[model samples]
Target: MNDVVNLAEKLAQFSEHWSPRVVAELNDYQLKVVKLQNSFVWHKHDDTDELFLVLQGAMSIRLRDGDVSLQAGELYVVPRGVEHQPYAEDECHVLLIEPRGVVNTGDAEDTRLRADNDRWI
Candidate 1:
């Protein structure tokens, strides 16, 4: 059976920053929603590319070459094996798509910021 997912309402259920909530699943990939603020650690995914879509506010992905800023409704794809860090000055809503079991902090582990997988909203 299939069901519709309301992103906004789903987002309303959680408020912790940097912690992503599983909203939906598509095959092997999981669609997760997160609220970002401040800075994230520099890390790289060795196996899979990650898609970051800004649902609201603003965000920037800092790479070795340059930093890419994304506003509401914008999106960016961080290719696999590329080290990058994400930051936001204010509350930013984001939707991330990556294969199931992908760690939130990538190769860099931050016990304070690491979120458990398969947590549904």
Candidate 2:
């Protein structure tokens, strides 16, 4: 547990966009690093809030009412049951913090954008 987990180093281990690689855990939550490009499916975790922290580049979380923009060193939390879709025009590195089993696509029926849970780098 003493080993340091460098976000940039772990982020470099994979190149697949929208797929998150687990890096660390705190209690029942998991810290994941994901590369994002283009747009993602609209989904929501009915049981848990999802956190998105921008490590590099920028992204936007589009809600039905509006949108939330995030740049490097910024973070946003999508409250539980809030319908939202994430999008990026270019390669964006993000740190996601959510419950261990919370699906990336949440309750959305579109399985194509659903990523494998608990995958580690």
Candidate 3:
């Protein structure tokens, strides 16, 4: 747990979009890195909020009320139970912060969109 984690280096290890690779853990929460392209399914976490921090390029989180745009070095937190659909025009890198075991697809019924949890880089 004392080893340093490099976001860029880890990001280069994988090219699969929407798959989050666990980078580190803080108490009950985990930090994950993911590559995003196109759009993600609309889903919501009933128990915990999800944080999306843009590491490169740009992305948007579409909510029922409005949409939140984020660029590199920026972040947005989707509150618990708030449905959000993430979209990116081009490939974007993102760092996610959420509770351990929190599903990337949240409550979405489409199993194909769900990513494997606890995958470390």
lDDT of 2 by residue, 3-121 (tens): 89999999988889999999999999999999999999998888998999999999999999999999999999999999999999999999999989888988889899788888988
What 10-residue stretch in candidate 3 is worst by lDDT?
105-114
**Per-candidate local distance difference test:** 0.93, 0.94, 0.96
Show model 2 residue runs off by greater than 4 Å: none
> What C-alpha lDDT, on a 0 to 100 scale, does residue 3 get in candidate 3?
94
Q: Could you give candidate 1's per-residue lDDT for residues 98-117 as a string of tens digits?
A: 99999988999766788898
lDDT of 2 at 66: 100
What TM-score do all the candidates reach, one by one? 0.96, 0.98, 0.98
lDDT of 3 by residue, 35-69 (tens): 99999999999999999999999999999999999
Best candidate, lDDT: 3
Rank by TM-score, descending? 3, 2, 1
Output the better candidate (1/3) by lDDT.
Answer: 3
